[model samples]
Target: MKVIAYGASTSSTSINKALATYAANLIPGADVTVLDINDYPVPMFSEDKEKEIGQAEAAKAFLDAIATADALVISFAEHNGHYPAAYKNLFDWSTRIDQKVFKDIPAVYLATSPGPGGAQSVLAAAKGSAPFFGGNVKATVSVASFYDNFDLEKGQPTNSAVADEIKAAVAKLNA
Candidate 1:
């Protein structure tokens, strides 16, 4: 499968990005493309900006990237219990290009944080609203206390149960 995966943040060293990349690699024999939202930067979306820039090339590029995916794995980064500003901005622009941003692609949504809450608030929001944007959400995983559960050197979850959960979630795309 051709999997398009990304963390929903622009941070240079995003834990969510690392998590997303790790999870995407778990799908056996899958070709994974890990994207950085920074590569598709766009001005913050607004009616006025839309009028000024009609259709953003970056937004179109973002959608085009999704079009190439057989499956998607997105790890959301929560900032103050919500989507990160940079991701939300690019997503808003992409929506303008097509409200169905995911184009019905089967997806696994994940979230991670250093704290115990696991960024579940944003994960819930993403899961709750995915269908509205045509995301075929197959599973969702939230990794809590990221530093404790994840092994940076190994680039995978140190907690065996969490690793299993993520593996199970990604496996659904093939199903």
Candidate 2:
């Protein structure tokens, strides 16, 4: 399978990106592309800006990346119980080209944080709105206390139960 994975954040050292990459690699022999939101940056969305600039090339490129994917693995990084501004800006621009950003591809959604909440609020929002945006959500995983649960050197969950849970969720893509 060709899986497109990304963390919905612009941070250089994003823990969510690490979690996403680890989860995408679990899909036996799958080819994965991990995207950085910074590479596809767009101006903050506004109707007036849309009128002035028309459709953004960056947004189209973002959609093109998704078009090549057989499945999606996205890990959300919550900013105050919502999407980070950078990702939200990208999404706003991308929707102008195609409302269905995921293009009906099956997806595994994940979220992580160094706290008990595990960025669950944003994950829940993503899962809830996915279908409206043509995302076929197969499963969702949330890793709480990310530093405690994940091993950076090993690039996997340190907790066996969390690792198993991530594996089970990733497996659903082929189902």
Candidate 3:
């Protein structure tokens, strides 16, 4: 199986990125490719920008990546209760090219934050929008108060309950 995973954030040391990597590692015997949203930077989406720049290579590349995935692992990093700028901008660019950006692939969506909300608002937003983008959001994992729950040395959640929840959610995609 081909698992394409990415943290929907651009920060160099993003906790969302760390979560995505850890989740991908749990999918037994699969080829995994982790993507950085920053790699697909396109100008802010706009009719004017579209007319000026024409077709965007980054946008097409993003779509092509999703098209090749047997399953997807995306962990959202919330910024002000929404997707970070890099991810949102890439998403906007891809949607202009094709509204069904995920091309009907099954997906595991996750979110994490230093606070108790666990980036739940963003996860809810992603769940709400996934169908429109052709993403089969099979399962979701949310880790709240990340600093307290996650261990940087172990590269996973320190709390067993939180860790188990993530494992269970990842299992749903494998199915």
| TM-score attained by model 2 | 0.99
Error of 1 at 107 (Å): 0.5
Query: Every model's Cα RMSD, please?
Result: 0.6, 0.6, 0.9
Ranking by lDDT: 1, 2, 3
Q: Residue 117, candidate 3: how far off, in angstroms?
A: 0.8
Clash list (residue pairs), candidate 1 = none
Q: Give the number of colliding residue pairs in candidate 2.
A: 0
Who is ahead in lDDT, 1 or 3? 1
Stretches off by above 4 angstroms in model 3 are none
Lowest lDDT sum, 10 consecutive residues, model 3, at 166-175
lDDT scores for all predictions? 0.95, 0.95, 0.90
Candidate 3's residue-wise lDDT over 17-113, tens digit each?
8999898888998899999888888988888999999868899999998888998999999999999987898898899899999888888999999
List, in order, the clash count of every candidate structure.
0, 0, 0
| Per-model TM values vs. the true structure | 0.99, 0.99, 0.97
Residue 1, model 3: Cα distance from true site in angstroms: 0.8
